[model samples]
Target: MATSRRVSRVAELIKREVSQMLLHDIKDDRVGAGMVSVTDVDVSGDLQHAKVFVSIYGTDEARAETMAGLKSATGYVRSELGQRVRLRRTPEIVFQEDRSIERGNRVISLINQLNQNRQIDDAVAIEEVDEFDDE
Candidate 1:
């Protein structure tokens, strides 16, 4: 079993190397369908598996295609990591689409919309009070 610090270090290294691969080494057309970026990497405590979180900016279909491409290229990525990283064994790579950013953006938009509606209502109330005072 690896210590927590070692596990974190490995996860960061994997994240950096995989980001480099996605940027330069990967040649899959589907991966290029969307603008993909690595959001985070989670490695198991044992260092036997790594989950690569990615945030893609595009339509739903494009996101799907990019995920499929990542899945298919797992073996290649593992091999490359094995070569570049001096680990006893390369951790298995699993690509996961991180939707947290999308969700957060949605929440922010909702809040903004609500604020606009509140301001409109307040203006209407103020106008009503002014008319009442004149009459």
Candidate 2:
């Protein structure tokens, strides 16, 4: 059984290498104008399958294009991995769009909106209390 730390380390290495390859090696036109970030990687316990989580900064269309490009280039990526990493077997690669960044941004926006609304309400309430005191 692979230790959690070992799994995490391998995941990090894969993410780094894959990101570099996407930026430099892969020459796919479908990968549109945007920054691609490898958010996370999940390697199976047996180290035969790898799920790569990527975050693309752009519209949904751009994200889809990038994902398609990645999927199409999976074989090359795996082969590259086989050459770069000293592993018994190069794991099959799968690309997935990470929505955690979007979710986090939404949460932050909502929190800011709530805080602003609360401030406005508090100001109004304070004015009302002051008016009553004056009366």
Q: Whose lDDT is greatest here?
A: 1
lDDT for each residue of candidate 1 in 11-77, tens digit (9 for 90 to 100): 9999999999999999999999999999999999889999999999999999999999999999999
All candidates' TM-scores? 0.96, 0.95
TM-score of 1: 0.96
Every candidate's lDDT: 0.95, 0.89
Instruction: Identify the runs in model 1 with alpha carbons over 4 angstroms from their true place.
Output: none
RMSD of each: 0.9, 1.1
* TM-score for predicted model 2 compared with the true structure: 0.95
Model 2: pairs clashing at backbone N, Cα or C within 3 Å: none
Per-residue lDDT for 28-72 in model 2, tens only?
877655568889999988788899998899987887888888889
